[model samples]
Target: MKISIYREKLKDKINNKKAKIAVIGLGYVGLPLAVEFAKKGFFVFGIDIDKKKIKALSRGNSYIQDIKRTALSELLSNKLISFSCDYRNIVKSDIIIICVPTPLRKTREPDISYVVEATRKIKDNVKKGQLVILESTTYPGTTEEILLVLFSERGLKVGQDFFLAFSPERVDPGNRVFNTSNITKVVGGVSKNCAYLSKLIYSKIIPQVILVSSSKVAEMTKLLENTFRAVNIALINEIALMCDKLKINIWEVIEAAKTKPFGFMPFYPGPGLGGHCLPVDPLYLSWKSRRHGFEPRLIELASQINSHMPNHVVNKVVELINSKAKHSILEANILIVGVTYKRDICDIRESPSIDIIRMLLEKQANVSYYDPYVSQLPIGKKSLHSIKLTKKNIFGFDCVVIVTDHAKIDYSFILKNSKLIFDTRNVFKKFNNSKVFRL
Candidate 1:
């Protein structure tokens, strides 16, 4: 095999910080990545289908919490970053990344429509020597099975004409300690040259890049990371149920276990697994495994258990309501303290609080929510806004459910005024309040 001229040229562009980069779907993953590259002096084209987001970026507004508006403003003024809804920039870029969403359909099947659409756009305008990488969370073989096939249909050879790789986005929203730049990036390419070029491009922005054998491994690496969390969380969720039955404090048990500091990692139980990855990624693997005649028994069971958590939480709410209000879930003024999947972030893709609210609405409960980070949330035909956490409002709700443990919210105020409290996150540790019922 000979050294490819295209690879060397790409390496030169990356090293010189002169690479023209196109990033599709500028949401949580893409915006941070594009900003990082632009901060590193690469000319980044931030593309998204959402014109609102483009308009926001055009005026130096940031829709993502982790990215600062000042950074975007500085970069835009310096002409290092450009935001648009156009895919025509694809032809002008040396490296193109697809950071689009890979959400599951209503039936819990993998919906790669966003990925397919982004890939199609790339294929329509992809030129020779441009490297394409997918940072979307997807099942193994998606890069080769879907992306490579789509690009090859455009008469582009993988390593020679265009390069392709999968570097799964390890974005933990609201995680201050580790981020898109410092976290180790795992890259797997369709070919050896593809992997090398992919690693090269990411190494320009992200500090650590690890090479895997193939795109399948890189794809599997992401699924495994989330599935591990989902499974362990399911185990802990199930144990929490057991502890509840045994009349034991699960939070206390976790604290005791943490004291060991070895062979024991504590996974807390909550409303359920939420966000983009944990609730959805494992099923993608299980779905693929089933297609390969392999039964991922543990994955299926864990998914079932995690999926039950939101309803379990609702049951806790019902239990609390019944103990006080002398009624069923019907007509109960249940307030959700925080609606986001996790604490202190606005991204609510596949959030369990949504599921809990949906289930509550199904049972005819009057549900309201409050989160400083989220202003409005749309559920079905009705939209719910975050309510004020005043004494009167807190007293109005029959029970308050702390779905997400946001730090800024005055928990003392909630415990002080609320009629009943369902503490899923153990926010009130050892308070021993009669109105506070913990999960």
Candidate 2:
């Protein structure tokens, strides 16, 4: 595989303001990438199959809170960025970056259908001197096994006629500290030239560009980063549970541990791990490892612990409610605070709050939720809408459960108003009263 032409084109694209770039799958990752490239003076085409996303982007309305309206308006007015569902525009572009979702199946298997379908779109419009970089997070060998096999059918050859690389998207939704332009991007190419060009393209936008040996290493780097997070979160969650049994505050322990400053980094305990990347990425690696007759025991164990968090929270809720009064499980008014997967973000994909709400309903608890960012959340058969989080509303609930610890929620107000509080996120650091129970 050779990519001399692709390397030259990439260098030209980096310096040329008119060089066209097409970003496929305009979700959290793609939309931001498109905007950043446009801001850097490149003609960016944002493509997605969903007409709704295209329509919204056309009107300059963004679904992600991280993307400001003023920035999007500037990009739209300059005509540097465009949105479309058409594939013809993709073929017109010099560089195409795939940022589609790679979710898991029911059996926790890697589901690359989105990647496959998007790659097929690229194949249909693929031309010579095209550079295709996949920015989606997936198992190792996905670029080689899934995409390379299909591209070989075109007979154009990778790295020679067309360039290919795998660059994982490190988009942390709602994170104020890191954004597309600042985050260090990792890129690996099929060949040396392919990697060089891949680095050249992203280097224009990002502050630091890290290059690995191969595309597989770049793929595995993403999995390793997410898996480490999953395991550490699991360990902290286990400690929080043990602290409950021993009648100690986990928050204090974490704070004291942070003072060590040498071998310590603090990770908070929550109801469970949620969000698209941390919970889903590990399963991709675990499934892929099986092909080599290897099982990731650590990954599996962490998953089990993370998955069981909702159950642990629900049990604590039940115990707290039962001890309060002789009321039946079906009659208690349960209010769940913070519905989004994490704090301050509207994205609720794989949020453990959904699981907690479902389990509560199954146990016959009358569950109502409150999230400032989210209006309505779909859990099983019911569309649980967010009630106003106020002193009056909090006064009516039998017990308020803290699922997501949004900064907007007044912890003191909640601790004072609710009859009893089940603090799963440990947000109420100052509350020492008997009415508050930490899970």
Candidate 3:
């Protein structure tokens, strides 16, 4: 059969609501995306090697806060979406989107194992004219270099018998403004046909769809967006350290800078860059660049500055504890207010709070934390669990450090109950006294 005839047949299936869409790796990015597709009236199958995750979705229970249980229940009741751990269903899927995790290795390298594994699983079952899209955040050349080779080995010609495209997932976990469906999606394909077909598929769900020239360009777009934030935030972090020495509030400086609203764009200073993207994604580009004999100096410098922030905060804690005549770290109880990377949502993928706690433990400091949003934090080197957040819980800690600024936390209660505090997020609207210091 001609490729165009196959494409037309697939289109007819989709129009008739007969196309089976498979979403691989049902995690933070994948689960929400699967739900969106299911809601859009597609027969969606959410596949994950994690049996527990599959079982939870089968029961219509959502692990992600953004995904409503009722939505899952509706999809399940309608028999529009279901979860599975089997790869045999791949043969029945008309379209497959890879939404696996692209994490950094211990050496700060891009680990594309999950992406590769997903491609390998689908390679054998890939039907003629099936549209395969990758929604994982990865470096340029990933769609071509990583995904294409796997399919080619299976004797399918891309853009002919099958299609391949990269559409980077821009899912912000807690952001109210953007979600899977409304966010502008950027897609690039290995060839012209691939681009057109990919855009057609996504245009059904996303409000706006942008088609880039090639897969590499689309991949590069995601990297540049994150690298821009990483560099700018590093610059502000440096300025914040200087302002602290000069007794100037960096938050006020940022507020004044934001007033122009013309040439300047505001990126605030924080305890440190955390979460999945800003902290880890930039390094993937930098790591890939090294193979081409290129050094991303700005990215490297930014990583250094951002990574050093937790240590700086820890030093401040040591200084404050010593200066106060109350108790030393050995006798003093230290409470870390938030454990998640950013506020509101409970995702600690690359959270800097882990680094802070580890450093404190190395110094023999008794450390405990309270994140109402995150009840249990995975202790890296220590066995300690999340501390309770109560008035009496606050009394035990000699000093508290605010790593994340959750909107739900009662600041008035903390201020009255805690002895002292080091506020990394400037959660307080107004400076009250010496007991509290804003980073």
* lDDT, each prediction: 0.91, 0.88, 0.88
Mark the regions of model 2 whose C-alpha exceeds 4 Å error after superposition: 1-3
RMSD of each: 1.4, 1.4, 1.7
Candidate 2 lDDT, 1-439, residue by residue in tens: 3436656765676677656899999999999999999999999999999999899989999998988888898899999999999988977898899999898889789889999999998999988888889999999999988888888889977777777999998888888899998999999998777788889888889989999999999999999999999999999988988998999989899989999969888988888888889999999999889889998899999999889899999888888788784566686899999988898899999999999999989888889999989999998777988998788999999999999988887888888788988888778767688888877
TM-scores of all candidate predictions against the true structure: 0.97, 0.97, 0.97
For residues 133-197, could you state the per-residue lDDT of candidate 1 as single tens digits? Answer: 99999999999999999999989888888899999999887999988889999999999889999
List the pairs of residues colliding in candidate 2. Answer: 2-159
TM-score of structure candidate 3: 0.97
The alpha-carbon lDDT assigned to residue 148 of candidate 2 equals 82
| Ten contiguous residues with the weakest lDDT in model 1 | 319-328
Residue 65 in model 1: lDDT? 86
Superposed model 3: Cα runs more than 4 Å off: 1-3
Tell me the RMSD of model 1 versus the true structure. 1.4
Q: What is the TM-score ranking, best to worst? A: 2, 1, 3
Best by lDDT: 1
